[model samples]
Target: MKILIVGGGMGGTILGNNLARRLAPEMRAGKVQLKMLSASDKHMYQPGLLYLALGRMTPDELYRDQVSLLEPGIDFEVDPVVSFELDHNQVKTKSGKTHGYDILVIATGSRPVPEMIPGLAENAETFYTEETALKMFKRLQAFQGGRVVIAVGVPHKCPMAPLEITFMLHDYFKDRGIRDKVELHYTYPVGRVHSLENVAKWAAPEFDRLGITYETLFNMKEVDGANKVVKTEEGSEAKYDLLITIPAHKGMEVIESNKLGAGGFIPTDKTKLTMEGRTNVYVIGDTTNIPISKAGSTVHYQVETLGENLAAIVKLGSPVREHDGKVFCFIECGKDRATYATFNYTVPPDPKPPTRAVHWFKMAYNKLYWTSARGLL
Candidate 1:
């Protein structure tokens, strides 16, 4: 039995470690082999990117060598996946290598699509990636703002990140004595500040208290970069001296090229975590069309359920476990305070108010995340 895992992000690396440990007996007997294929040697601690813009973290701290993060006995290859022969259970890489697998796990994850909106790629700035986050930090520092807008296209990873950045920006500007000089604005496609109604309700008062302006149902249509303005499909316009936009997100190109599902996302069984119409293939993380926020917390919970299910299938010929779609998010409120929320697919989060202790907990969790990825925590 051979397991091929595609991707080495938070979900892929953790799943590889879990699978390596669970299938150790088979591996020792030469009955099972585990290999991971990643596009790059870098595995980023993405959650820390939020703090990177706030000067609390650096780029070096957010990334580790991907091969070093894998568990012992797991083979790792650094190559770009060109296509997947799903019917044949084989994957082709850019280096013209083909690999066959008894079981395949697609954890390729999501990426920003700035090209989805007109003028967005040329005009807007973002902090979703380490490169972009650090660039935005410099832009924020040098901004002599008239209007600063934080806008999202749609369906981005880390549901709370834009809000956290908005809060941090308020603090960032105030500390620099430019709070009143800059008007902070946030725009989202959804009708609420957050996807969850209850979380949005909680955030309403916080937005008011912070003096941040928020616009709902503002589906960005185009960016007039030359004029320094943003126009939405709903016939609204905002002039921004500096624009920070969370570009539209999409699943991996390999998935799309193979026609796995609409928009490159696999339509997966929410509970079973298996690809529709395929028992030997599993899908997890942002690659799945699951109605959950594409956050590391979601992946963290999915990993345990996936590991249990995969273990059962490999050893017993069937899966007895089901995922609960549980996730938690820690929202930074700046001023060294943060709020925490926990929920599942069936429940909406009723977050606690901001607290300084939770802020420290979030900071501590960043260090724990590194060890956790290495399967030490």
Candidate 2:
């Protein structure tokens, strides 16, 4: 059996490594072949971009050679797929090669589209990618004191990033002794500060305690960069001297061009984790239109369930696992403290207060992510 994996993001890496370990004997016996195709040879720990923006981590620490993280039995390549001819059980790659597979897993992932909002790309600072994070860091360094506004959009990755950055900004300006001079304000699209009800409930008081002003029901329409104002779809405006934004996200352009799913996200079965209308093709991570937070833990958990089911299919000729929508995230609260949220489909998240221990553990996990990707943790 030829198992082809597309995209080398978090979901792809873990799933590739997991499958290699589970099907090692089959691979050795020439019964199963696992191969992965990615856009780059370097694998990035994406969550570290948040810390990179805060000057807590460096660029060198965020990357590893993709080959170093995979198990021996898996074949890895840096060529990206340009066309997905699912009907033929094949994909055409940029390298002019067509790869066939019995089972295909698409984890092409998502990208933030600040350009979608008029003038947002030129006006606001974002930390979603390495280039943007570095620019945002420099912007923060140059910012002395003014109305610092955080504008959030929907379907973005790392759901807690806006709140985490807000708290971090409070600490940042406080450290610079400009806390009194800076007016930290946050605006959200929905009526609540967060999509998660309990998280929104927990964040409100935390914002109050930190003296961070916020306005909900503020959907982004466009940015008046010259006037230093953000016009919302609701017809309200937020004035700012410095604007930080968590822009909306969409799946890869290849997915869009292929007409896989709306906005590039592939329609996926919430429980089976398979692409709609195709049992042999699977979807995970930011690629899936599952209406869940597009966070790393979501990818991590989905890979776990997929690895088990794929292995079960090889061993039992049938699958026996369902993704439970499990997700976990560590929310940095600044002040060297952090908290976490864990939830599944049946259970809602109830976050606890920030603690230094959890913060340190999150720090440790940052280093251990490579091990986790190797299917060792």
Candidate 3:
């Protein structure tokens, strides 16, 4: 059996390692083969991008060699898959080579497309990537003190990011002795400040405590960079000296070019983790239209179920279990305080108040992520 895993993001790398270990006997016997194809040779701990933008972490701490995280016996390559010939049970890579597989795992992650919103890319500061995060950090440093309006878009990664950044920025400015000078404002597209109801309930009070004003149901329609104003779909405009936005997201371009799903997300079975109508082809992480927060923890739980099912299929000729939509996310609430939300499909997250201990744990997890990527945590 040949297992081809595409995209070396958290889901692919961890699942690859998990699958490789579970099928070690078969691999040693030459009965099975595992290969991974990724666009980059370095794997980034994406959560760090938030801290990077806040200047809490350096750029060098955000990456590690991709191959170092993968388990042996897995043939890992940097050639990116440009074509997903799912109907033909094969994929074509950037190097013009084709590879066939008995089972395919598509974990190609999503990308933030701030440019999708008119004038957003040119006007607002976003921290979804290394370049953007560093740039946002610089912008934050130079801001003298005025309206720092934050707007959010749909289907973006990390449910708590907007809230997290807001809270962190409150502390950031306080540390700089300018918390009173800067007025922090947040805007969310939904009726509440956060998509998760409990989180919204929790964060609203936090916002009030921090003196952060917010406008809910405020969606980004266009940014008038020339006027330093952002017009919303709701016909409201917010003027800002500095604009920060959590832009919308879409899956990899290959997913779009291959006509996999609308906006590049692959239509995936939420429980089975398989592509719709295709049992042998699986989808995980940000690539799947799973309607969950696209955090590393979501992918981690998805991988837990997927690795088991894949190994079961190889050994027992049948799969076992289903993904329960389990996700665990730590909410960093600045001031050396943090809290977490852990839930599954059937449960809702009821996050407690932030604590310094949890904050330290989150900080420790930043370094321990590589170990977790190796499936050891």
Candidate 4:
């Protein structure tokens, strides 16, 4: 049997690596073949992009060759997939190659589309991509003191990133002795600082302690770059000297073009992690339209059942598992301190207060992520 996987991001890499390891015996016996397709040759540690924006990590340290992360048995293709012929169980890529598979996994996560809002693409600064992160770093370096706004867009990959960057900015300006001169503001589209109500309750005190202005229900409508103003859908507006935004995110154009998405997100079975109608097709991570944070930990948790279910399908003709929707994240609180929280479908997140230990743990996890890519952790 042939297994085809699209995308080489965190979810894709982790799933492919884990699956290859689990099916090693089948691979050796020529009973299964695993192939991974990616649009880019470079694999970026996405969370590190925040540190990269803060000048805490270098570009070289944040990226690796995509081929280097996979085991020897898995086939890696560096080609952009243009279309999916799901009816035929095949995928067509820009390289004019067609790959057929008995089972297909669509871990092709979401991508940032700043153009969704008028003038956002050309005017606002972002840290969602390597290019944007590097650009933001330069902007941060030159920023002396003024109104700084950090806007959190919806359906973003890292829900904690806006808060993390905001806290880091507190430290960044404070270290330079311009903390008082720089007025920091954090704007969220949701009713609170975070989607998770409990997490938001925990973060409120921290934001207050840091003297950072927190604005809720501020959905962005358009950016008046020429005026350095961000206007919300409710007609509220804020001016900024430097605007750091997590622009709206959407599924890849391919998924939408292939008619597999509802407003750019794939509709899947939350319990079984399978495509709505397609048999032998599965999706995880940011690609799914689940009402949970699109985070790496979410993928890690889903993989627990996803891996088992896929294996069961091959051996038992059906899956016997379900996704728990477990997700957790460490929120940076500046001054070398951080906090953590865990949540799932049925439970509310209980956030741990800021501590130096959690901060260090996050730092260590960045290194360990490499191990995870190799299916070792």
Better of 1 and 4 by lDDT: 1
Window of ten residues with lowest summed lDDT in model 1: 368-377
TM-score of each: 0.97, 0.99, 0.99, 0.97
Q: Per-residue lDDT of 43-99 in model 4, one digit per residue for the tens?
A: 888898888888998888888898899988989999878989989999999999999
Comparing candidate 3 with candidate 4, which one achieves the higher lDDT?
3
Q: For model 2, state the Cα shift of residue 196 in Å.
A: 1.1
Q: Write the per-residue lDDT of candidate 3 for residues 10-92, one digit (tens) a residue.
A: 99999999999999999999999999999999999999999999888999999999989989999999999999888899999
Q: CA shift at 56, candidate 2, in angstroms?
A: 1.1
Error of 2 at 139 (Å): 1.2
Report the lDDT tens digits of candidate 1 across residue range 68-185. 8888889999987898887999999999999999999999999889889999888888888888888888888888768999888777888888788888889989999989999999
Ten-residue region with minimum lDDT total, candidate 2: 368-377
Tens-digit lDDT track of model 2 for 45-145: 99999899989899999999999998998899999999999999999999999999999999999999999999999999999999999999998998899
Tell me how far the alpha carbon of residue 240 in candidate 4 is from the true structure, in angstroms, after superposition.
1.4
